[model samples]
Target: MINYNPKEWFTFIFRFHKADTFRKLFPLMIAVSLYGFILAYLELEYWSLINSSYVKNLSLMHSVLGFVISLLLVFRTNTAYDRWWEGRKQWGALVNVSRNLSIKLAGYLEDESDRLYLSKLIPLYARTLRGHLRANVNSDEISDLVEIDKTHIPNQIALRISGRIFELHKQHKISSEQLIILTKDIDVFTDVCGACERIKNTPIPFSYNVFIKKFIFFYVMTLPIGWVFSFGYFVVPIVVFVLYVFASLELIAEEIEDPFGSDANDLPLDTMCNNIEKHVKEILN
Candidate 1:
């Protein structure tokens, strides 16, 4: 994610970054300006478009079109943000649960080797889950931690950790109650994995995406015709600004919908995983 300092209002307005929306929308803004300029020149200078009732009536669309599309966009953006925030919360919960697991092992296991073995696996489970969500499990990062050959590496890692705790219980290193305590945190790990996987697999509906894209496309494209009467040649900048607002919202929703990825606006999974690892190691020590 792009980190920045909080700034005054003037600085906020003038700030610029390599935001995905800006890069994607720049060409569209230029195209909108050129489209508006052509329409204004043709209608006023050549006087061909000004004669048509359709050209004159285009601006009348703003009242109903603006209101309805705004409502739809509100729903669309909210749905996407909900998914993004939910993913963040799940990862945050995972970090806490991993620490909890480490603490339980430290208090229960007498042998330092057993505690170290199980506590180390907490961060490995997290890294494996990250790889699972991103669909790119790196062997080098996880090869030493688990068997690495299993297709479901995260779940198997969770099971292996649980199985070791059971072995510790069988050896009388920990009681049955300690086994339950450690298993409770293992359950939490699995729950978090399931929740994050749900977010990754279940996206917003296809119909909603299709409808929004079509509505925004035609609406922005028609703006040059709509506002050219009063603004004339000045419609170029107006259309560019208008397109920027609408398209930026659409792009923001798209960028945030899948928060698992390493996009600038995404949930910062790498940082969260690193924090989990650090916390786990500290508690295990």
Candidate 2:
């Protein structure tokens, strides 16, 4: 995420961050403007054709479009925001559960080496989950910490952690019931990982996206026709601005729909991971 002072309103308005919708919609904005110009010229130069009943019927399309498209945009934005917020919540849970696991192990385990080993594993699980959600796993950082040769790093990490709890039970460091209680934390980690994976894998329906884009396209294209009759050449800027609003919203929806990504609008997974590491280490120390 791009961090800056919230009071700097001018910077907020002027800064063109990579995730800014305007930058993504620039080419489409130009196209819409050019189309507006063409419509204005044609309507002004050849008044009779656009003045005909059939061409006038196209104005009715706008009547229904404004209300229907507004609803669709609202739905699209709401859904994407829900996903983004849920992703953050899941990661927050992961952070809490990591701390809990560390504290439990440190208190229950008799051996200092066992406590240290489990403390190291808490962050390893977090690091592995971060890479897992990003769809790019690098075992180099965790290879020594977790001696596992498995594709699903998060699950493998959880398995090893759970296995440690069982190991404690076998050594009588923790009783059978205590073993069950501690294992629940690993289950929480598994559940958190599952929830994150669900968000990362499942996205907004593609057909809905295509339909909304098509609707926006046809609606914007017809704007020049309807408005040019009333607004004249001024419709060029009006149409361009309208396209910017519609296109920018669509672009934003796409960006936030997948919250685990490295995109500017995405949840700050990397920062959260680092913070989790720091907090877990602080507690262990």
Candidate 3:
């Protein structure tokens, strides 16, 4: 995600990041401005709707619909943010589990070879999961760690890790108590994977998303039609500003709703995965 100091208000106002909604919506804003201007010119110079009560009353309709649209946008933005935050929490849990597993194995395994094997495998699971979430699983990473099914890479890695712990238990390398402790951490690896998949696979309902977009479109399109009587040509900028605000909210919601993707607003999976590797190495090595 694009990191910045929240305190720097001027920097944010003066600068436009590539992912800024303003940049994405600028073309549409220009089109809406021109459309508003055309409607205003036609009404003032030709139709003479300024004196008509019917045209003037349309603003009241907008005022009521404006409240309804605001509520929808609020719900939309909140729902999207909840998904993003949940994904971050899952990754945070994964980091802790990786550390716990590494620490336990380091204490339980006396053989340098076994510790070395886990040192590589623990971090590889994080990297594998990163790739899995992005839907670009790299078999080479898993192959380097262990030979297992590539169909479900994260599950395979978790299984491999569990198998090693079980093998150690059978050989009396670790006691029953140590095996239980390590199994708890190992089980969470799959749990975290399943949680991330849930967030990535499921999304807000289709009808709801389409309804909000339609509401914004029709609302902004009609703004210049009604207000042209009072504001005349100035309705052009007014309509464009309203469109900018409403459209920007939808764009932001879309970007953040799928937090695993490459969007600037997505959760920082790359950095988190690197940290997992670093922490695991420190504890196991």
Best candidate, TM-score: 3
Structural RMSD, model 1: 1.6
Clashes of each: 0, 0, 0
lDDT of 2 by residue, 1-285 (tens): 667788889877778877788877888888878888987898879664656666666668787887899899999999999998998899899988888877776677778778777777788888888888887888788778676677799988888888877887888998887788787878889898889889889988889989999998888888877767667799899888978888788888888988888888788888888888887777666
Q: Any idea how many clashes model 2 has? A: 0
Cα lDDT computed for each candidate against the true fold: 0.84, 0.83, 0.89
Q: Which residue pairs in candidate 3 collide?
A: none
For model 3 the TM-score comes to 0.98
Using lDDT as the yardstick, the better of models 1 and 3 is 3
**Candidate 1 global lDDT:** 0.84
> Which candidate tops lDDT?
3
Clashes of 1: 0
Span of 10 residues, lowest total lDDT, candidate 1? 6-15
Deviation from native of the Cα of residue 149 in model 3, angstroms:
3.5
lDDT of 1 by residue, 1-285 (tens): 767666655776766767757678888788778878887787778876766888778788875797888999898899999999999899989988988888877877678888788767888888889999999888786667677667888998898888898898899999988888778888998999999989999988899899988998888788777677778777888778878888889889998999999888988888888999899889887
